[model samples]
Target: MASIHIPTLMLALLSGFAMLGVQLWAAQRSRLRYLDLAVWTWGSWTLLAGFAMLTARVVVPVWVSALLGNGLIALGIVFYNEAIHRHVLGRALPRWMWWSAPTVAWALTAWMLTWPLAVRTSAISLVFALLLCPAILVLLGPGWRGESSLRAVGLTLVAAAASLLLRSVHALTNPEEYRDLMQSSLGQGLTFLFSFICLIGAGFGFVLANFERIARRMEEMASTDGLTGCLNRMTADALLRHELERGRREGTPLAFVLLDLDHFKDVNDCHGHHAGDDALRAFAAEVRARLRASDVVGRWGGEEFGLVLPATDGPGAARLVEQIREAVATLRLCDGDGHDFTLTVSAGIAVAEPGGQLTADQLFMRADRALYRAKDGGRNNVQLHDSGWELGMESPAA
Candidate 1:
């Protein structure tokens, strides 16, 4: 068997880990604050330190090389596992879990110092395999099913665990072939090579995963209103057009509603724009609470919102809007001066019945006209538009 240069592989791995650690540190500093990236950066540096100690086992004290080195490596794996847990589930493991694996591995390695080289190697390899198992489970779990980068990291962990397991079994069954840590052997060489590959794969996978998260967040921010947490005007318009097309194809009823807060300018003038913002946010929340998940609500510019209701008729849409109006009236808000106040909303609804050929503009115009009627009838009321040019009775203002 061709002897693999163990020292040379260790040096290369140390260098690789150092570079990966630096990149991760830079990413954590420059990009969005991700808890997982910070944890992984620490893990990379910890692993680098452990590898450095292991590489110098020839000159270092046996206790330092065997106990501290192995302990750090196990701790580093724990950090990696914790990072995966935080990234996927958005929570950290228990405090005890952070120290349990490293403590146990350190104690066991210390006790096994008097044992043969093969026995010590087998024991440590098993410890590494155990340390990596949780990370594998987290990355490959059902929660992250469609994340390809996470899956890649998961697969790399699986391979690393399998390699560690193989090394453990190989050392135990073929003790004479693994006499020394620095000796050139096929088993040691393959194990180290696999470790190196796993490090590179896992690091790259994490970076890609962070990028994916950032991109998704950017898309959401672009489509969402910053203050009210509703869909922005442009996204709402696009959604209305798409729903209109779908409703026409399926012959389903669709309702478009225009809602505006009554006397909104007075609130801003009386309580300042900050209070006005609070009212808008509260109104949006109440409206969202009363809406179905399939319903679409968007901030249609200042103090005005648009709703797209699928499979809703004229009467159903009116009832839902009335409920939203009552809910808004019950909201007790305080201004900057600690003065209590309430708000009312006026809504106008236009329904397109099945098989109707109403264009988006025409539907919007009808709804807009109905809204003006509601405002004119009273400050707070619900009005519906029908094909016969009939309007629903206005609800009394609270």
Candidate 2:
């Protein structure tokens, strides 16, 4: 077998470093998804350092080469897993997990420093495979929530882990033939090749995932209100029409709630437009907090918000809007001067009966008419278009 030279591994390490730079540049140029970029960049550095240390194994003490090289490579695996979790789950992993995994793996590497070279290498391979478990768990847990690139990331990692396990078992079974892994050996060459392939595959997968996320976020921003973080009028109007069609076709009830802040202009006049924006944000927060996940809330127009609740009847939507109205009353907003004040909302609810062929505008107009009645009867109340005065429940405190 031709001996695997140190310069060859150095070239691979250099390649990884170059890719990391390219990924960093792409991240900045696009101005999106720095988390994956940062995580994978660390992974590249760890692998590069590990390979550099491995190349010096001939000059260094056996224990130092084994400990540092194996420890760093294991750490690279852990970080790749962390990147997967971040992109897929949109959350930070527990501090103990990524923080302590490499430490613990390094401890294991240290303990195995005195063992036979083949045995130690095999044991470390097993540790590397185990370190990949976190990423595997995330990828396999549930659906990707519409991001399909996550599946590729997960599968690529799974293949890498399987390859590691196979090498571990092979080394353990034939210790005599694979005793010196640092030398030009077929086993070592294969391991290095697999590591390089995994680095390329998973790295590209991460880039693709981040790009997909950026596109989706851009779409969201386009369709969303900047201040309130709710759907904008255009998107809300389109959604109402879509839901109306579905309710008509599938025989499901759909309700729309139109909400206006009582005396919103007064707050603006007294506290400035900034305070008005704050109140609008506060109102949107209450709407989000009190509504069901299936319910869609949006900024319909100036000082007016709309809600689309699928599978909801008139009374059910009434209770939801009433709860939202109460929640709004409790919201406290601070003006530029740091003084806090509360706001109340007037809500009007209209329901499209199952199998009804009402248009989006029809539903909107009905809810809007009820809103005028709530304004006329007095503010801080929920009025239903279908039930008229009977369902015109005014807040006792109002």
Candidate 3:
């Protein structure tokens, strides 16, 4: 039986810790709790400390290595379990369980110090396996279903736990053949090697998961309005064009509703620009609440918004826009001094001509004309686009 290479295992633990530490710092600086990267970082550090002390057994007393070193390793496993429970299970592990598990692990390990070498080895292995059980169950549980990354991480942890369990089983079944851990049989050597490899693999899997989340958030921020949390102008334009093409092909009606806040300049003058910003957000929220989920709204520009409503005619769009206008009229906004004031919105509706060759730009122009009519007639009403309404005519139809 070949002896387990203690130095080699310690070096692997050290290297893994170094890499994970750098990644933890990067995650911290980014202000992202995207994954359980912070928890994993702490686990790695504790595991590194345990392995370092064990490797220096000559300088560190035997009892210290047997008690404190093993306790640190157990704490590291508990941390890893917590990370899995939170990120993979999508829920937090109980606080009592987190503290109690480590207390029990340390107490049991210390008590076993007086036992025979083989008994101590078996006890330690069993304790570590028990420590990993919670994380393993969560990974295989229903919460983790359909997640490939979680499955990969779960499988690696399972293998590491199995290795520990097998080492314990081997020690108990073949007590005569059991030797010192650093000078042991094939089973002991494989256990250490597999555990080291699994730890490194889990670290990489967690880091990759966080990076994927960051990428998704970046894409969303780019396409969404930062202030109103609605679709931005560019994203809205593209989506509206796509909906227009689909409606044209399917012979369904599509309508574009353009809304402009009436006398927005007055609000900014009375209160501060901060109040004006609050008014804009309040208006967008009311529009969203009054419309259906399928209705798409975007911040067209300052004091203006646009909506693309599928399968709707001019009258239908006008009714929806009218509801939103009434809702906005009821909205009360607060100024810096806590005074409240109501605001009104003007809307223009342009329904797509079924099976016509009209482009999105032409649709927008017609809607803009209707919006001008609404502004001209009275600054707080909805206007549907009239075919006879001319863009440059002074008295456009309302």
Candidate 4:
């Protein structure tokens, strides 16, 4: 209960500010400067503000300081959560979640108002701690894709918790000592708050850095395919829709092409499974080599590929797929046998009509049907679709 040390609190405030400055300086140098950078930068500044609040706590009574400290901590957590949601959560938090801030504030106000002045302060901190338990567990929970910042947030909360526990334990043993300490200039409260700021401020700094790292990682995971390192099926569909919309809006044509490797199952059968994987990888590489910078290619599924050709019409897409097919046919997978193995791909292309309604699922389906028709007519051929047609072939397993 000893009063917070004014000089130490000032030092903590300045140190926290210095940490914020460093965090900002480093944030600017990072490659991806967006909401993530802003969140981390703001988090550092909040820690400094929280430190200032703790410093102000010493001049006020222990009960007042505790309330203020709790409020500041809650605000800091709110900012941290916002950073996570902006960078990590693909969606926004619901309005119901907005109540947590004022709830913590109310809890702090109640705690301060209910402090017993005549007798000793009970272990009331326990109740607030228990209240915060759910939030703390949320940060450390399995669902948190916010791996980088979660530990830092947890550490900050834990530091505040330790201070509370320390003060509570000390107060129960010696009431007079606790009162005298609260009255003194460097009583338990100042020591506790100062210690809390140093430990938790540093923790917040770590959390900010992690927020950036985790956000970047999340983006990579969302947009890039794990196996081939190209765009994933989800991203490919999204990109197709985006490009189609753009083309429609600008009165331009965008091409959709579907490609399927012929006799791919035989390749898996003739060689070991690992060799089939290598062949698929080699086929992807060969196909990629024939593509232009404006084209986007992604594996639609096992033995299937989806291509998006922005600004290209149906004929252009056919020519591109034909080039890819020819390039793939020329590729020879060599083995120890005297004869070399060859691979071929059949392709289908379609152009989006101006003012035509097309959904991604429907577009892919049309192109895919064309691809199967080409496969049925003859392997390694391009079938360009003018209208929807069924090939009557069974869909392959993904």
Model 2, span 296-353: residue lDDT tens:
9999888999999998998889888888887788777889999888898888888999
Q: Residue 76 in candidate 2 has what lDDT?
A: 78
The list of candidate 4 runs beyond 4 A from truth reads: 1-211, 334-340, 388-398
Count of backbone collisions within predicted model 3: 0
Writing each residue's lDDT as its tens digit, candidate 1 over 262-363 gives 999999999999999999999999999988989999999999999999989888898899999889989999999999889999988998888988888899
In angstroms, the error of model 2 at 247 is: 4.7
In candidate 2, which residue pairs clash?
3-184, 4-184
Off by over 4 Å in 1: 31-33, 142-146, 265-279, 332-341, 353-357, 387-398
Which one is best on lDDT?
Answer: 1
Ten contiguous residues minimizing lDDT sum, candidate 4: 117-126
Over 152-243, each residue of candidate 3 has an lDDT whose tens digit, in order, gives: 78788888888888878877887764555455456666766786678778777766666765776788899989888889999998988998
C-alpha RMSD for every candidate: 3.5, 5.5, 3.9, 16.6
The parts of candidate 3 lying over 4 Å away from their true place are 1-7, 22-39, 78-101, 117-151, 158-171, 174-178, 290-293, 391-398
Report every candidate's CA lDDT.
Answer: 0.86, 0.78, 0.80, 0.65
When summed lDDT is taken over every stretch of 10 residues in candidate 2, the lowest stretch is 389-398
Task: Give candidate 2's TM-score.
Answer: 0.73
Ranking by TM-score: 1, 3, 2, 4
